[model samples]
Target: MTQIDRTMSLVRRAVDERISQAIAERRDEWSDAGPAAAELLDAAADLLGGGKRMRAVLAAIALSATADSARREDVLSGRACAGLGAALELYQASALIHDDVIDGALTRRGLPAAHRRFATAHRGSHWLGDAEAHGRSAAILLGDLLLSAAGSELGAALAQCPQGTRAAGRAAFDAMAEEVALGQYLDVRTESLPLPDEGADHAAAGRAMEEAALAVVRRKSARYSVMHPLLIGALLGGLPPHGEGARRLAELGEATGIAFQLRDDELGVFGDPARTGKPAGDDLREGKRTVLLALAWQRCDAGGRAILRRVLANTRADPAEIAAAAAIIEECGARAAHEERIDEHAERARRALEALITAEAGLSRSATADLASVISLLTDRSA
Candidate 1:
């Protein structure tokens, strides 16, 4: 296997094992509490099992810059890397638990979503008041539990690292957690708010809409998924900065993450269900006000704009309407436009990657190359 694949495999193993161990310990701790603990632990484990392990992989990639060839494997297996990798994955599990609740999504990683799983149980067991309400309440608490566990995991990981490094890593993790929560609020808010007005200028209003959606992307995806993990890992890895590009990693990471999120926006609207693991046009069904929809408003005609504004976020919009919305997006050139933006940000990330690597000492060319290679996977993958 390629070095990238190998590193990812190892990190993936570390994430799984770490998360499993954490849940098992919790299970043991709550052994006297009965099946409720079992349900919560099982849900957390299931969510943790579903991700691409990309966040953990990003952490490992940052660590690679500080390790020599022989020590790379050592570093991966070290207490530090294992701790960081596991911590990052566990944190993601917490986020997904809440995200599913917010999005009202029925599935995650091809399985029933956390909230839905609970609701299904409530219905199947034929017990309780409203199944959905009970499910939502359980999910809220479960998400909170995972969030707390993630913080504990981070604290544990930091215990063995230098004080300065620990502080930096913790700062990134805490900042990201806060941003994601607020970002989710902004997303929910955007969906509830009316479209921006631009008098007779459909184009200007479209730009306004796009800006709002991009705001959600910046907080919810770019910072949360990619940038913060890079910061936390690099800080924990303790690689000193050295070149002109030394200070730009944050900007680079953010740009790279935005591109990744924009691709996700596209997939939400036009993705294949079998590959994406959610229903096709699930975004439309949920009425998510993404950049894709914003761009459609900006560029399309009045009929197209009305079509989007009318049906894009209805949640009750039908399949024919969803299909019509998708067609309008492609026809009005939003799909192409959104794709162009993804390419633009990806190119920006490439430049930033080179700069960040060049800014650091002892970063191998292959290490630089490996980090660069992940951009495509982030932006172009089907699932």
Candidate 2:
């Protein structure tokens, strides 16, 4: 494995241990509540157990990017960074739990989604008014529990840093929560709007669609997933958002995040089920208004545009229509355009990382190089 891989592996081990600690404490704290409480904690653990732990690693990268003269070892082992990786993982788990319910996704990472699992359990117990409703309600509460858990752990992480640094990091975390909630609402609003007529003001509608799609990425994932994590890590490392090295990290984070989500948008429509652990054309079937689809609709002929609209309008699309939609996406070259955008963002992130190497940040040469590799792995991922 590469050096970054090895380091992340070790970091993952640490983070997992911290996660276990969070679970254990919660389990005890809620012990008086009943067995149902245990189930919620278990659900959170199940969701947290898997994945690449990319957010945690990105946070680590930001923490390490401060001046080489800073005490690297002390920072890594200190409270400011401690439990942070696990905290991020928990926060993500909470988001996914709610996301699965919102999207009506059946599975996550090859397992039944949390609500589905809870519904199954409710059905098996034979004590529910509506098993599915029960499951959804439980999952919502479970998501709330996870948010609280993540916040608690984050508070602990901040406590280990200086007061100024702690305050700044906490602010970033708070802003992240607010932005993601608002972004999700925006996404819901956009999805509910009527489809525009291709014959009337097609150019203007297409432009508006593209703008809306990019806005989703910007607010929902770019800042929430990548930028805030970097800012929080940098703050913990003793630099505010405008601090030395912070701007570069922020720029790199935004670019990497945009590329990352764009890659996901591609995979949602084109990824292999076995590799991605999800059904083929899942996003297409769900009528996700991705930038890819918007661009495809923009360039396709009238007949092709009709097909696109027909498939998207049918949320219960069968395999044949899903296949047809995928074909249309490719034939219109929307996939290529989306990929080109990914390449652009990836290059931007690469340049940002490279510039940081010789910049005034004074990051250790080894840490700087490892960060470059990390950026590559993040943007170039397939599954």
Candidate 3:
């Protein structure tokens, strides 16, 4: 396996081990709560069973980059780093579970989403009124449970860190959690904001849409997905969290994270189900106000705009209409523009990392290379 692959495997194992142990403890502690509680833990296990472990891998990479050479191997192999990686994974799981509920997504990672799974179980067991409602309610609590677990795990991880650095780590974690919640709220509110019609000034409307979408990306995905993880890992590695190195890593993370989300937006509408594990045109059905859609609005004629409006949020839109909307996006050069934008963000991230390494911003050479490789993989992918 490649170095990155090996690192991912190790981190995945650590994440799985941590999750299993935590869930088992919870299951035992809550046995008095009855079968309903047992089922909740089962759902958590299922949802946490598999993933790319991107956030965990990033945390490991940053720890390697910042930790002193004499202590590096020990730190990487010790419980502290493993716990931190696991904590990040659990946090990511919390976000995803809640997001799927928000999006009404039926599946995640090729399996029923948390809410859907609960609903299916409820129906199978012939439970009481409103299986779907029960599912949504349970899934929300499941997400919250995972969030609590994440905090507990982070606390365990921090206890292993030096006294001076623990507060920084905790602060970073809290900031990430708060930012993502606010970002998600912005995303929901943006979806409610009406899209401008063809008669609206194209430039102004396009700019407003793009700005709104990018705001969601910045807070909801960018810093939450990349920057905070990097900072937390760096803090664990004994680097001062607010130092020049942290600043540089934040720059790299924000740019890389934005590119990652933009690519995800592109894939959401046009990517193959087999590869992306999501139905084609799902984003259109969900009416996500992505930058790609914003750009398409800018370039589309009235006829094309009408077609988009017809299918943009219409979950019942026929497959043919969805295909036409995708076609219009491609024809009007929105897809191409979106790709160019992703490239710009990715290149900026690469440059920031290069500068960090060249100026001895504290990252080791190998760790920097690994971070670069991961950034490329994240931004340029089929899924």
Candidate 4:
């Protein structure tokens, strides 16, 4: 197998093993809690099972890139990589679960969303009042459970490393957790805020909207998705998390991650449901205040703006209305503008990657190449 495929395979195996262990432990501990509890654990397992494992792979690459040659193989094959990969996967699963609940998403990865699954089960069994409410509550608790498990696993993972590594890992972990939470809150708050007036200074209003949206992208997705993962791995690989090497990784990761999220925003509006596993225009229905939307609002005419305002956040919007909104976005060149922004971030990440390579910061050739591949995939992917 190619190095990238091998790395992905290793991380996937580690994550699967860790999740299975978690499920078994929970099952045994709650044996007396009945079948309902087992089902809950099963649901968590199901949600945790599917993902690109992109974060875990990034961590491994960072570790491989920085570790001493003699120790590299041992560490990559040992508990540190395994534990870190698993922890990152679990953490991502938790975030996705909570995010789906917040968005009131009905499906995830082509399957019913956690809340929707629970609601369906509730209705099927004809148990309890307010099936929808029960589903949301259950999904929230499930997300919390996974979040707790992630911390515990991460702590256990770092305990086997050196004292300095442990400290660095914990610090990065804590910072990432806090930042993402703040980002999510900001995103929710942005949804309630009024859109900029159409007659307002167009450039100034566009900048404001873009800045606010980028804030959400940076904290909510970028750092969480890339920077912290790379930092954690660098720490475990014996690079000081605050040192020059770590700083370079952070810069590259953040740039790559920003591109990744901007591409995600584009996909939400323009991607095929068959590939994305969500319906077309799902973001419009959910009224995601994305950079793409902000730019489109700035360029659209009054009628087009009215159409967007009416369709956004209106979950009941029909397909035709969604088509109208999407067409407006395309015709106004917002989609193209969004793509240009993604390209800009991608180029920034490329420059950072080149700088790191030129500095000869001890990254292995294979790992550096792998990092390059990941950056491309993240920014240019269709789904």
Query: How displaced is residue 56 in candidate 4, in Å?
Result: 0.9
Q: Residue 16's C-alpha lDDT in candidate 4?
A: 75
RMSD of candidates 1 onward, in order: 1.9, 2.0, 1.5, 1.6
- Per-residue C-alpha lDDT of model 3 across residues 1-383, encoded as one tens digit per residue: 88667667766677678778989999899999999888988888887887887887788778777666666556565677778887888888889999999989988988899999999988999988999998899999999989989989999988887888888888988999999999999998998888896678986798789999999999999888888888888877777766777778899999999999999999998998988888889999989999999999989888999999999778898889999999999999999999999999999999889777776667876577778898899899989
Candidate order by TM-score, decreasing, is 3, 4, 1, 2
lDDT of 1 at 132: 99
Name the top lDDT candidate: 3
Which of candidates 3 and 4 reaches a greater lDDT? 3
| Candidate 1 structure quality by residue, lDDT tens digits, 1-383 | 98788878877887678778888899999999998999888888777877788888887777666677877876665666677878877777777778889888888878998889999999999996999998998998998898788878888888867776777678778898889989989999988887654356778777887898899999988978888877777777775433354356676778889999998889888888888888778887777888888888878887776677667567777788888889999998899999999999999988887776656545666567667778778977777
Stretches > 4 Å off in candidate 3: 68-74
* Model 1 lDDT at residue 167: 73
lDDT of 2 by residue, 1-383 (tens): 87687557756777788888889888888899998888888888888888988787777767766645356545554455557877788888888888888888888998899999999999898984999999899999988888888898898887766777777888888898888888887777877787887667765677788889889988887888788887788777776567547788778888988888888889888888888888888777666778888888777778877877778746688888888888888988888988898999999998887776656775676567667887778777779
- Backbone clashes in candidate 1 total 0
Least well predicted 10-residue stretch by lDDT in candidate 3: 68-77
Ranking by lDDT: 3, 4, 1, 2
TM per candidate comes to 0.95, 0.94, 0.96, 0.96
**Model 2 alpha-carbon miss at residue 2, Å:** 1.7
lDDT of 1 at 377: 80
